[model samples]
Target: MPQRILIIEDNKDLAHLLELHLRDLSYDVTLSFEGPKGLAEAESVDYDLIILDLMLPGMDGLEVCRRLRKRPAYTPILMLTSKSSEVDRVQEKPTNGAP
Candidate 1:
């Protein structure tokens, strides 16, 4: 089966672009525009990888990452953000280091 990937980004254009590229690479991609919806999707399915954005509507990527880490299953997460500070903030968190 193709590897499943979840992308949580607020930018519709960017999300679609990413989905297209991932699909080309033979991945089963899922896109979520907001944090809450992304979180729900993450919980419902088993994804091999999760592409998360820093600034989201309901919750930030850091919070989402933190919550995902709390789950029993471990899914690799790749955080995408324009802000360099956000990267530093995520790195500071205790959750099992970034993937």
Candidate 2:
């Protein structure tokens, strides 16, 4: 079966382009324009991967990722954001003896 992917991005053009490329790679892609809608879709279906935009209507990508992580079903998340600070925040990993 083809791998299922969820793309939550507000940019229509970018979302379409990403869908096209992922489809070419034999992935079943689902797109959402905003965070709330995306979060709803995520809860309803099982996706192997989630591509989330950091800046979104209703809720931000970080909140979405946090909520997803809290769920029993663990899905891999790839955050898309232009802000370097946001990337840094998301990419941070705990060091030894660090909170």
Candidate 3:
């Protein structure tokens, strides 16, 4: 069976494009434009992976992740963020000795 996936993204174009590409790769993909709806979809189905956008309507990806982590069953989550942040957030030491 194809691996099931759920994508929670507010960007319609990006989400649709991703769905198309994943489908071509033989993966089953489902999309939700908001955090709450995505959470509902996730609970209703057993997805192999979840592609979640950091910024969302109704709720943010951080909150969604927190809630999902509370569940007994484990489902891997892949979070995506378009916003740029400090390199330290990724826990990497700068090669140039910069913070």
> Over 4 Å off in model 2, which ranges?
85-99
TM-score (all chains, Cα) for each model: 0.89, 0.85, 0.86
For candidate 1, which ten residues in a row score worst on lDDT? Answer: 90-99
Alpha-carbon lDDT, every model: 0.92, 0.89, 0.87
Name the candidate that leads on TM-score. Answer: 1
lDDT of 3 by residue, 1-99 (tens): 999999999999999999999999999999999999999998889999999998899999878877887787678888888877675247344233248
Q: How many residue pairs clash in each candidate?
A: 0, 0, 0
Superposed Cα deviation of residue 62, candidate 3 (Å): 0.4
lDDT (tens digit, per residue) of candidate 1 on 1-99:
999999999999999999999999999999999999999999999999999998999999889988999999999898888776755665674567635
True-structure lDDT of candidate 1: 0.92
78: Cα error in model 2, Å: 0.4
Distance from true position, residue 56, model 3, in Å?
0.3
- Give one digit per residue, the lDDT tens place, for model 2 in 1-99: 999999999999999999999999999999999999999999999999999998999998878887878788878888888777756666755222236
Q: What TM-score does candidate 3 reach?
A: 0.86
